[model samples]
Target: MSLDTSTRGFGWRAVQFLTVLVYVFMFAPILVVIVLSFNASQFGGFPMTGFSLHWYAKLLENESVLRAFQTSLWVAIVTSIVCTALGILAAVALVRYEFPGKEWVNTILIAPALVPETVLGVGLLLLMRFAHQPRTMWLLVLGHIMLALPYVVLVVQARLIGVKRVYEEAAMSLGANRLQTFREITLPLIMPAIVASLLLVFTISFDNVTASMFWRPSGVETMPTEILSMLKISISPEINALGTLMIVVTVGLPLLGGGLARYLARSAR
Candidate 1:
């Protein structure tokens, strides 16, 4: 028994060590970028020349960067809203009802995420061309919605699957209608998942580059694409500053959403 206990402890310790290593591997680059954003030197490297907020200042002063940032923010916000609404409806239909071609509908809805980004981007571009539609922000928004829909659907559907229908039935027995039961019970229960999906879709849309590249209109740019263009010219510390800010916003949002979800879940319980 002592030997078995020792083996299990060792296994746990090993797992903990591996988990730490994985986190370090994932965050090491972000750490480097954050550090370099504060570096006084223009070039990024180890052994910082000094500390300064010059790069961050430059980031604020750069009009193109600001424009791109705004563009990305706008797209992310719209994508999140549209995707969340559609996702909730789709999740409800898929989970609460059975219809003809349900399987095909589910497959088609999620197929965008399964397909390669390059292929999807190319196809979208071709479709737009064939349809004689001019490239526009709406097109980019549509692309992001397509990309993010599957994730939102999956998250909400998973939450719905674990939820008991008895709550709705109980509400109905108390003289509540379908809409009333949903608003008072089902909606509150699913609020956490919806919030989580909104935050997740926002992040995905903001960070997307490959698919956005094809859909971007002339004279328009997203932060990711702007960063790519800047890199082709030269790596600037300002990019690092922008990246650090993005990391903060992206990481902070999901954390905020998680906290909100936890509170809602506890309150619902």
Candidate 2:
């Protein structure tokens, strides 16, 4: 091999090695948590120490965990639905219309995601206090919706941008009203994006902790907050099991959504 060819080969090999190292570094902790969740030992630590589903079974028996899980599920569902509905309307308006301060409106809509969670949480708390609003599950739901809305709007907006205005015009030319054109032609084109947004928003709300801590009622706890309380005392295998389930959720929903989006995209074509 020429000197230049040898140099290029070594460079490519170095890049590949670094890429693998980066992925391992990122995922190793998650893999360890998953493995340890099945550990039969009383303490969470090194060595296999045998394997069992005892931790998972214990999760079922823990009333606090179950209640917290239900609370988290309810918040996620409400947040996702609200965000998806509002996101679609906001995205369509931003993409399809030319109004004053449109850019500013877009910026304001997505600002929640850009801001630090601590800042957002504190701001919302102060706002609630100023308005004489009590902290409650509804407040938690609202916080999650704010955090998740940007993602939904961005996803739906991208899909809408890819769609041609001519399609809507064509439908209108055929005597279809604006609403009919949107329902029949535009909605189908963006259904995949909407579905993906729903799942994405659901995952975000499910995993939220910082904002949840600020907005949740005094006695109530969501799963993440409940897990935080557990950590205050000790690190138990049950926590690992809970973390594993969360991993399955936060990771799985996006993967499932991506697959479904791909299927829908192909079907639309």
Candidate 3:
């Protein structure tokens, strides 16, 4: 018994140590970038030459950066809205109804996520060319929607699975129609998941680089593509500053969305 207890203790300690190391490895580079973003040095690299917000100030003054940010924001907003709406419908159909080829439908919907971004990007570019379609903001929007829809579907579907259909039945039994029942009962229950999906899709669309590279209209730039351009030119502190801001937003929004989802889910229960 003592031998078993010692072995278990050692195993637990090893797991904890490994977990800590994993976190450090994941975050250490991000931490370095954050520090460098605020560095007073003109260069991006480190030797800790005091702290400053010069790069951030430069970002504020740069029209191209602002324009790219606006473009990214617009795309993210549109992608989230469309993805959430379509995702909700798809999740409802998948989870709440019986249909032919149901499994196939689900697999098809999520296949884009399973495919490599490079392949998807190239495929999209080729398709556009084959279709004789000009690369446009609309093209970028569509690509982002395709990439983000699966996540929204998965999140809402998971929530829908946990939701008791009996509530909808009861609402319908109370003389509510199917649409009415969904609006009054089903929609509320799944709202947290919808919100979470919206935020998550926004993050995905905003941070998208690979597909955006292929789909973006000529002479246009989103923030991610803009950063890539800047990197091609030079590794300025401005890039680090922009990166740090993106990290805050990309990391913070999901956390906020998750917490909100949990709180809302608990309240619904």
Q: Give the TM-score of candidate 2.
A: 0.95
- Model 1: C-alpha RMSD to truth? 2.3
lDDT of 1 by residue, 1-269 (tens): 25555557777889999999999999998899999999998786666899999999888999999999999999999999999999999999999998999999999989989999999999999999999989999999999999999999999999999889999999999999999988999999999999999999999999999999899999898999999999898878888998999989999989988999999999988
Once all C-alphas are superposed, what RMSD does model 2 give against the true structure?
2.5
Q: What's the distance in Å from true for residue 130, model 2? A: 1.4
Pick out the ten consecutive residues of candidate 1 with the lowest summed lDDT.
Answer: 1-10
Runs of candidate 1 with Cα error greater than 4 angstroms are: 1-5, 8-19
The residue pairs that clash in candidate 3, if any, are: none
TM-score of 3: 0.94
Model 3 is weakest, by summed lDDT over 10 consecutive residues, at 1-10
Write model 3 residue lDDT over 50-100, tens digit each, in one string.
989999999999999999999999999999999899999999999999989
Error of 3 at 136 (Å): 0.9
List TM-scores for all candidates, in order: 0.93, 0.95, 0.94
Candidate 3: Cα lDDT at 130: 97
Candidate 3 clashes: the total is 0
